[model samples]
Target chain A: MGSLLQIAVRNVVRNVRRTAITLAALLLGVGVMVSIRGTLNGLQRSMKESMVLAQTGAVQVHKKGYLKNVLSSPLHLDMEVGDALVKRILAVPHVTAVAPRILFGGMVNLGDQTLFMATLALDPKREFEVCPKRRDLFDARAKAFGTSADGMVITVELAKGLGAKLTEPAALLAPDKDGALSGENATILGTMQLTSPGERKIGIVPLPLAQHLLKMEGRATELAIAVDDLENAPLVAAALERALGPEFEVHTWDNVATFFKDILFRQDFLLSLIATVFLVLMLLGVANTMLMSVLDRTREIGTMMALGVRRSRIVTLFLVEAAVIGVFGGCLGGLLGSIVVAWLHVRGIEVTMPTSAVPFVIQPFVDVLYIVKIVCLSGIGALVFAVYPAWRASRLRPVQALAGG
Target chain B: MALVELVGITKSYELGRTVVHALNGVDLQVERGEFTVVMGPSGSGKTTLLNIIGCLDRATAGTFRFDGEELGDRDFNDLAEIRNRKIGFIFQSFNLIPVLNVTENIEFPCLIRGDPKKALRERVRQVAEEVGLGKFLAHKPDELSGGQRQRVAIARALVTQPQVVLADEPTANLDSGTSEQIIDLMLELNAKENVTFLFSTHDPRVMAHARRVVHIADGRLVDGTDSGRAEVAAVAGMGAR
Candidate 1:
């Protein structure tokens, strides 16, 4: 076995030019796999990071009916209790930042087009420090989402449908259970470019204005909690659930940021699909290469057999050769894949989304493990592809082979 | 004891709709330290008989005892061990592995046997020197001439110190001069090492080296003669002069 290994290594090296072609194919497969995995993972990472860093934060702490009903009625408790909860949260090591949010459900109507919208109230002074990009959305949503203390910002699609621009007041209507129409003058302050179909029909205002307009006194719909470790979210949610009881539900960013999560899921599915495709192609390539190598070495193997090398040994030799190719190709693919993935990490891949309705283009942010995945995947693919050719090479008879070749 | 004995050996191969008789009831014996050369036209089963004698192929029906061991298709590994440890083969085209250097090619069978490195290196060196392949140790088969490659094949055949070396049309690919030179080398090796050499050939130069000759036609032995023994003795006389 040891002697066989030595022979296999020398043969591989001596046939460097031929072996290099297989290596190149392997490396190419790895590069594509690594780069793609990295980019998709990076995109997911960025969205998650941005979501946590921004005011929407990690875990969205809300009342039980917050999502299901959305009636602008979140049971508000004492600020002292909220502060104590915040302190309790801060006591846990991984807790990062916490933000309060007020939500009001209403209809935004222009001449005849009326669209149901969520009127979220935010403290822009603190929100900007976390979200960091209010100015960009200021023009798109007009008064819908912005840096000012007065007026409101609406999503671009909502504003356009309403025929409302900057400084134009969009009608805000909230109807009580008794069907009493309550209207408020929401002057345009800024606009937010929505990332999804749901968020696109949104309007934003000052927390105080949103409270007053919705006639909800000193009440917040949810408390958004951010954590230092994204992986620690479930622990944090359980802790929050323990701290807050059945009256409230703690939701992780993965659960609350439905749009972002879906996008990440779609990204994952795409990567998996592409990976499956490349692996199949790589398998075919490796099988083809091994078969060709077997054909090339047939006569040589026959001579070895004639010289007293066993048929079993002949098979083993060919198998060992294919394994050598697989291992080398796999390792090369991994190294090249890792390097490419690392490069992509440092210099990100940018894609711009359509600018009319939705405005934030997708950006990918990658890390290290994605690179490791590509290399391992390539190695596995190569090994899987080597089986048949090795078997064929071992099946040859020395006499006929010598005679034929 | 006879070095090789085959009794009533018959071999048939399936050819689509019929059986082709490659060897039929062949009875022969070759003594130790003898050089036996077989000759026939193509399809006359010369190579098949050589393969059977070398234990590369099993007889379809019959008995063969090489150095007192019965030859039958029993275990593939045992047959391989027999081929590797006791017998060496030389091909007409000098079937040296294309990728192996001359030294490595020579060392192949021993390497397969997993001989110790020091011992293998010494054996490879000695054989290369014996075949005048000392300078071509690093050369691949393609890099060597037809004559040089044949030398490497001869060196490979003897490297393991096998008692019997089988050469099948050993000079088919070489020129007349090269063929004569190769025959002389095999004859010299046979005399010096006292190794039994068996050859399948139609080449006259090859026939010149044989101490015994077996002629086969249509898968049957036509003549077994010793005209070669006298020639071998005459060559030895000239060498003495």
Candidate 2:
């Protein structure tokens, strides 16, 4: 067995050019797989973080049938926000904090102009805790704006449409619980920017003020909950549902952001397709090279067989040669891929979509164990592709092979 | 019992629609420690006879016994075992593995049998010395002259110390002077170590060195003799001079 291994190594080294070409194929295949996986993983992480911090908290709880008519923000389906319900929610194992919010459609009047607005009324202190990055959307001057000030923060686009300025008074008009029109006066404290220009007609005000103006005191349409770990959001949501009873529906970030989830699924499918194509191409290249090597060594094989080497040994020799190429190529490719990933992670890849106002920075990363598994898989793949050619070499008749060129 | 026994050996090959008989109804016996040669022309059955005797191929119809064991129905692996333990082969092309140096090529047969490496290396060096390849142990086949390469092949054949060594026109690729040296080396090894030698050739120079020469034409032996013990003694007397 040792001598056979020696011979196999020498055989692989005999034709340096062919071996190098095969190795290059394997190297490029593995390198591309690693780099693409790392980049996709980074992209997924960035999207999930944005969705959780900028739009939805880790989980949300709403009254039954509320999501069905969510666009209308029906006040009839509102849940009572009491100390008891908040305490019950906080009792769930991983739940850290909960913020009550009222989502409603209203019209903002700035004396000369009036425009429709989608308003989210929440306890500013609690909302900041549940979604820490939410405050980053506001301008620096409004960083201290909270529950103490009786003011509203409208999106820059809405403020522009209303021709409104900060510190100016505005009238917010909407239908109260009894389907009667109600109005409230407040100061426009600041303006905020959203990721998408189409979604910039939003306004945020204090929870108490919106409840009073809508004639629904101590009630909110939903509760956005935060957990210790984002990855365990679904489990925490499940526990909240079981504890809060069937009257309320609990949703994780992914459940609420269905569009983003669909995009993620498509990305994964495309990555898998690319990986499969690379593997098949690498297999064909290796198999062709091995078959050519077998043809070239037919006479030498005959001499070995006539000298009493077994057929199984001949098969083992070829397989070992393939294995050597696999291991070497995989390691070198992995090294090169790691270097590229590290550089990209530090430099960051900024992606700008035409519909988005901000560019997303992706930081690619892959662990050492993942690289190790990829290398081992490459070695196994090479062995699998070499089986047919190795068997062909072993099946040759000594007499006929001796007569071959 | 003789070292090799064959009776009514017949070999046939199918070429498209017609059958070609390369060997027909041949009976022969070789005793232990004899240097013998089968002398025949190009289209005769010399190679087919050697192939059957070397266990590289099976006879189409015959009974063959080697060292008291019947081999007519042996499988490929079983024949491989017999060849590894009992028979050695030297090829006409001096077919040393090009990547291997002289020492590695010599030790290849023993290594295939899973012999102990340390002892096999020592035995390999001893065989190399006996074949006068002691100084060329580190030289690859491409680096050596024709005669030196043949000496490497001879050492590879002798390192296993088999009961018999078969050569199929072993000196066919060498010049006349080199061919004489290779033949003389084989004769010396045969006389000194009592190693059995059976080879096929049409070269008169090579045939003159063998103690017993059997002539074959078409497929069967032309001379109506099998053992040739008396003829071996007479030729042995002349070869010593």
Candidate 3:
């Protein structure tokens, strides 16, 4: 066993140039995935940071049926109940921070100009310690998510579309089931910053005013909690479920983050499918190198056979050489990929948007899981590539092989 | 006692509409300590006969008995075992593994035979010394001269101490001087180890070293002697073409 391993190592070393070429292919493939991972993570960070100014924390807990049937239903009547749940869940072992949230949706009218949008209400006092937005993000979401002195902030895009701004009297009208407009009206006290039009797509209001406007007095929409560590999110989620009991559902950052789960999955699958072609090509490069090696040493192999080297052993030698190339390449690729990803995670990729998406931010990312994923896949890459060449080498006839070229 | 025996061995291949007989009902016996030389023109089945004796080919229509075991229809493992344990082959091109040192190249046969460690090592050491490669055990095949390569191949074959060593045109790839050197080494080794050496060659010098000679043409053994030639032609006519 040991001698075979030694021979396998020697065979790889003998073709140093090809081995280097193969290793480079493996590394480059792994590196691409790693960088993609890092880039995505950074985008998420930018999103969450923007969200903290809007909501705070990774997870949110809302009243039963509030998320699914918010527009028309039995509204959560008490903000106190949500506050209690937030306090109790934050007490859960892995839970780190907690904040409350409220939502309001209505049509805004600037004179005769009217636009429909949703609104969210948050406590700016509590938001400061968790995810305060940077100057650029704050300035943007302010127009879409800003609060007024009357504590009603409107999105910038919504304001422009409605020809309404701070201190403008924008009629907040929503239709009840009777086809009669609720006839609610309020002054646009202030304008919120905009990170995304989607964020501004929601009107901005203080919690008390939002509770009044939504006709659900003293009731909050949800409680947001930050956990001690991001990785412990699942464990913390389960614990919160037990603590909150069957009456209220516990949620995590990943849960709401997955509002785009299907979309993300489709995106991920599309990316991986495209990336696999490169992986296959890289594997082919490895297989091609080994096949060429076998062709060049046909006589040597024949001689080995006459010297009583088993056919299986000869095949194993090539396979082992490929395996060695795979293992080394995998490690190097993973390392190179990981370093590149980690760098991106620390220093994010900047992105620009076309003029149409103005007032909406798009951040690119570095996801650590993506790096881990590529490193793990590199081993399988090497093994699969080496199979054909090794089998070919093993099947050579001793007599014909011994015959010189 | 004979080390190997072949009874009515025949082999053929079909090419388009033609049936080519590589070996045709050939019968022969080789005893221990004999240098048997088989000579033939190309496509005359000399190499095919060597392939059969080396356990590298199966006889299509005959019984081949080696050390009391019938050859043919054995699985690859058994056939490989027979080659490793019963016969050692030296090819015309001095088939030494290019990646291996001369000593490791020689030790390969012993390794395949699964000889005990102490025994395998000692055999490799002794063979290397005997083949005049004691100092070149670390040198790969390409680094050695043509004659040295053949000697290394001879050492590889004899290291396992198999029942017979099959040398199929062992000097075919060597220059005249190198070929002479290789043949002399084989003769000296045969004299010392008493290992039966069956060589298939067209080289006159190789035939000179053989104690007994087997001649073949058109896939049938022929005697070059006038009376024997007449008998072979009469036998060929008595059969088919």
Candidate 4:
């Protein structure tokens, strides 16, 4: 250590009780901040992954005018599904899987009760390659899934609300592209869970059955493409648009899910507020401790002043001491936080999200970049707080201080 | 010219609307290499005079000169520079930094002056040996006795090779034996190095070691008529001036 740093160390070591108290405050503040940030990051990651895996996949492909009138479920805007188009999209780099879907809205009747529901028809083999089917997610009979020619799947919440059972008959009433009311009969296969409680009002069936019911043969509303790395979804979407031609439009999950974006915005705002509060509190703690130390050392400071030491050197001395405390305490807190986050990463935290239709589990993630940022923040806060006290010490008159006034 | 000359110096302070005059038109002078003592009772402004002489405090109105340079309007920074390069101070309580060892405390002034590192170590060692603290260089202030601590203070004062060393009651806290020993050591340094010494005290034993005695009472210098020889001569010189 340099002479000044050595002097600061010795002084800090001489007052063990004060040093310990200051260190404790800094340690707890930094540790809690790091852990909280890690947990929030984990929650955000789990929510985004859930939405992508269960609904939008990484990107969605649709006809040029399909999304504008999608709420009306206009069958005239549906794209004709040819094997060549599917093959061309599948050939795009990073395009892991592509599943064709036809979406429609209608009423589901279980004898005494009739409920409005949005419906999705998918190809069993291709859908399984992209997203987990209801049969794969739960225990059901072998024939309950995979192109039974007349099977349907509904959310568990929807089944309970309608008082329906598996292998039972249900009726769906919807409109065809020609403005005719059409009805179809299906047997309930099984039920599954979804992230959004609002999505409970949905049912699923095979693509061919939906085509037959709507009288729009060999047509699909949109194609949901899965990418091996979801982070590269935009690039793949761009490539898919070029390969599938300008007749189609591409939409990433971020554009399709406004709810997730809103939730993320709120989460980030709350976390930032928490971080600011912690930083301010820690800064005050450091400032208070240093001010008291200066009070106790008034005579000693006067002696230095009388010895011809400059005022700036005195201020630098105190600042260096505070920075030392910050570094030591920050490292200790970071280690403790990392240990906790590591434990959560393995054991996982089970969270009951009321907005989710099912139980949500999140394993808290530890971001190295976030940890580094907090450490820097803590160190800088400590220095900033020391400024006032150090300046106060430097301005003391040697005559008054030496006389014990 | 005298090494120190203070003429008509006055200092006052406001304490809650009441003005307290600490120094009142005090005139004094001391030639180079003089071992002088300012003797006074309690609250006689001995400390205030010493503070002004040390450049740690400024006079409210007066013409004060050191080495024939007028210091009446010098700023605090210039006064600090003058103290660093020309004068050394020894407080009555032996104000050594508690955290630093004896050698570090002795070399502290040099460090503030930004002296060369290698030569500063040798000078510090020489001073430590000169003060008979060669073996206690690594000992902190608390580990040493009262007299030993005072010796460390003296070494620190002399380390900068100052032209004058001002001590405020250098023996006020010591017993009779230690006080005599400290006085003897200071006398030896004064004679060997030809360094001027100015100290304040009420003790007769302390005054006995001084070549000239300047008496102070009620913030002004009084004639030392009671003493003979050196005192009467110094008082007569002031009277003539």
* TM-score to native of every candidate shown: 0.87, 0.87, 0.86, 0.92
| Reference-based lDDT, residue B157, model 1 | 89
Candidate 4 lDDT, A213-279, residue by residue in tens: 8887888988988899889999998998888888889988887777778889999999889979987
Off by over 4 Å in 3: A48-53, A71-78, A81-97, A127-131, A134-136, A140-148, A164-167, A171-200, A212-217, A232-246, A343-347, A352-376, B116-119, B224-241
Off by over 4 Å in 4: A65-77, A133-143, A164-167, A197-199, A241-246, B224-241
- lDDT of candidate 1 over B103-128, digit per residue (tens): 88888788788887777887788889
> What's the true lDDT of residue A80 in model 1?
23
TM-score of chain A of each: 0.84, 0.85, 0.81, 0.91
In the range A277-357, model 2's lDDT, one tens digit per residue, is 987798688889889999999999889888888999999999998888887888887888788889889999999655455
Q: Distance (Å) between predicted and true CA of A155, model 4?
A: 2.6
Any residue pairs clashing in model 2, and if so which?
Answer: none
On DockQ, the stronger of 2 and 4 is 2
Predictions ranked by DockQ, top down? Answer: 2, 1, 4, 3
Interface RMSD (Å), every candidate: 1.9, 0.8, 2.0, 2.1
> Which residue segments of model 2 deviate by more than 4 Å?
A61-98, A104-119, A135-206, A226-229, A232-251, B224-227, B233-241
User: Model 1, residue B179: displacement in angstroms?
Assistant: 2.9
**Candidate with better TM-score, 1 vs 4:** 4
Judging by TM-score against the true structure, name the best candidate: 4
- Root-mean-square deviation (CA) per prediction: 3.9, 3.9, 5.9, 3.7
After aligning candidate 2 to the native by TM-score, how far in Å is the CA of A181 from where it should be?
6.0
For candidate 3, state the interface root-mean-square deviation in angstroms to 1 decimal: 2.0
Scored against the true structure, residue B160 in model 4 reaches a CA lDDT of 95
